[model samples]
Target: MKEFDLIKQYFAQRGHVRKDVILGIGDDCAITKVPDNQHLAVTTDTLISGVHFLADAPARSVAYKAVAVNLSDLAACGAEPAWISLSLSLPSYDEAWIDEFVNGLYELTEYYSVQLIGGDTVTGPLALTITAQGFVPPDTELRRSNAKPGDWIYVTGNLGDAGAGLDILKGNIEASAEHRDYLINRHYYPTPRVLAGTSLRRTANTGIDVSDGLVADLSHILRASGCGATVHVDRLPVSSALFDTVGAQQAYRYALSAGDDYELVFTVNEEQRGNLETSLANANVKATCIGQVNGYTGQLDLRLYDAKYELDKDAGYEHQF
Candidate 1:
């Protein structure tokens, strides 16, 4: 199939259709409308075969993850997702693979009411890049630079499951049948906390989605906010699947440094603590207080029930180049 034919057959008219998209697909450019009094939030992510996922991973999973990671970035900014443009590079035109991938991509876009406006397709190494755009009310967007000293640090949902799941896929760890499926599913489908993030805009001083592990991502907040934090290692949330499969010590390590859990980590001050709880409860999202921001600028202190804890390896994933 020709590139334009492939786009028309699989993508041009697929997924949720948003009214704000004035012109989508078949055009040189997509024109979208931003609602008055709101700001647009944009994020782009690229996933390469063998680097982001196993080359033989399911096409559905690859497509789902590609969209989810970008949505997670918008969620961190407390934006409501509205549109996406997908650029897909494939080694060959495998119609069956494209079908599965489009199904997975539309599943998420439909759920979030995101429109696939336009993009490009080409023959090359397997890779996918998605540029996702969303909206947030002016002055209400969540940011890493807004955290203040004495604010309580909190994270939505459990951590470390995705990291452990990757290990299982790479044959570096073993789990029982039940635990294995659960962990692998977590790795394949990460939930971006859209509602929770929007709710936090009214309460959280700052926030970030946990993509590159808790320690690494939180350090971004510290550096941006010019504040230090004291995180209680015992407070880091670990799922039953991760803890049961890897034991306490290894689970804690994964929670701290293994990365790829797309849950939100946010900070809320004492004055808004009550409101934070109420807001998240209303959003039907679970969150835990892991620590507090401190006066020491650009420092992160990890404590295990009052004793100092240190990471024995690199904090999180970083591109070598």
Candidate 2:
């Protein structure tokens, strides 16, 4: 099938879209109208074939993650899904691969109420890129720079499952069937906490998604907010399944430094603690108070059960060599 033909067959179907879209695929460009008094937030992410995933990885999962990662960025800023454009770099045309990939992307766009707009495709080494645009109320968008020294730090959901899952996939460890399933799911289908982020926009003083390790990602928030933190290791959330399978200490390590957990890490002023807790409960999300923001400059200190550890100032995942 021709490239445009494939796109029309797989993505141009009306059933695959939700509202707020003025135009979809098949156009030279997607025309959109942002609602009144709303600010648009845009983010783009690229997943290279071998660098981001194995070439043999399922095509559908690759597409889903390609969009999901970009959407995760929009959610961190409390933006509502609006539109997406895709760029594809392929080694060859494989109808089966395209079908599965479009199916997964369509499913997510439908769920998030986003529209598939316009994009570009070219022949090259296998790679995928997604640029997603969302809308948020003016000045109500959450940011990483608003946290104050007296604020409390909190994170949504457990962390490190994805990293553990990757370890298992790479044959570095053996896990039970249940543990394996849990880890694999974590790796494949990470929830981006979109609803939680939106709800907390007005309340959270600082916001970030855990794409990098928690300690590292949270440090971005700290740097932007110009405040330091003391994260209580005991307060970091970890799944019971993790402890049963990976052991407590290992689980703690994973929860702290393992990346790809897409949960939200945020801060709220001490005076708003009660309101923040109530808001999170109403949203049906778990929000754990992990620590407190301090006036210390440029440092992250984590206090475990007995010992304290300070993270290397420059530790984080970087794709470039």
Candidate 3:
């Protein structure tokens, strides 16, 4: 199929329809309205085959992950997702693959009530880029620079499961069938904490989504806020599947350094601690208090029951470029 034909058949007029989108697909530029008194939050992410996902991974999963990761960025800013534009590059046209990919993309956009705006399709290496836009109330957006000393650090949902799942897919680890399926699904379908992030706008002093490992993402908050943190290593949340398959030491290492979990890591000061619990409860999201911010700027201290704990290697994912 030709480029425009492919877009019309699989992408245009598909997915959730948002009223805020004045002009979506088939337009020179997407025209969207920002609600009065709200600010626009925009994020873009690119996923390349073999680099971001396994080259042989399902097209559906690749599409879903592309949308999820960008939405996770908006969630960290406490924005309500409203629209997305996709730029897809494929080595060649594959009808069945495109069908499944559109299904996956629409599945997530529908769940989040996001509309597809506009974008381009090009012939190139397999890669997908999504630019997601959302709305956030002015002065209420969560930011990494807002954290303060004495604030308690909290993370929503378990960590390390996705990393473990990647290892299993790579044949670097083994697990029982049931556990294997669970871990693999965790890797493919990471839940972006949209509801939890919105709830945190009023209570959280600062916030970030755990795209990188917990330690790596938290370091961003520390640096941005000009503060440090003391994380209780034992308090890091690990899924039963990961713990069972990888033992305590390996599980802890994954929790500390592995990426792609997409959970939210936020901070709440003592004054807002009670309200934090209530806010999260209202959203029906569970969060664990894993550490506290400190005065030492840009420092991350990992402690296991009051004893210093150290990782054997560098923590978190980093691109060589």
Error of 3 at 261 (Å): 0.3
Best by lDDT: 1
Q: TM-scores across all candidates?
A: 0.97, 0.94, 0.98
The digit string of per-residue lDDT tens for model 3 on 1-321 reads 488988887777567777888888986898889999999999999998888888888888988899999999999999988889999999999999999898888889999998989899999999989999998998989999999999999999999998989889989999999999999998888887889878998888898998889988999999999999999989999999999999988998999888999999999999999999998998899899999999999989999889999986675675311
lDDT of 1 by residue, 122-177 (tens): 99999999999999998988999999999999999999999889889889999999
* Rank order (by lDDT, best first): 1, 3, 2
By summed lDDT, the worst window of 10 consecutive residues in model 3 runs over 312-321
- Evaluation by lDDT, superior candidate among 1 and 3: 1
Q: Which residue pairs in candidate 1 have backbone atoms (N, alpha carbon, C) closer than 3 angstroms, thus clashing?
A: none
What ranges in model 1 sit over 4 Å off? 318-321
Model 3 residue 303 CA deviation (Å) reads 0.8
Q: Worst 10-residue stretch by lDDT in candidate 1?
A: 312-321
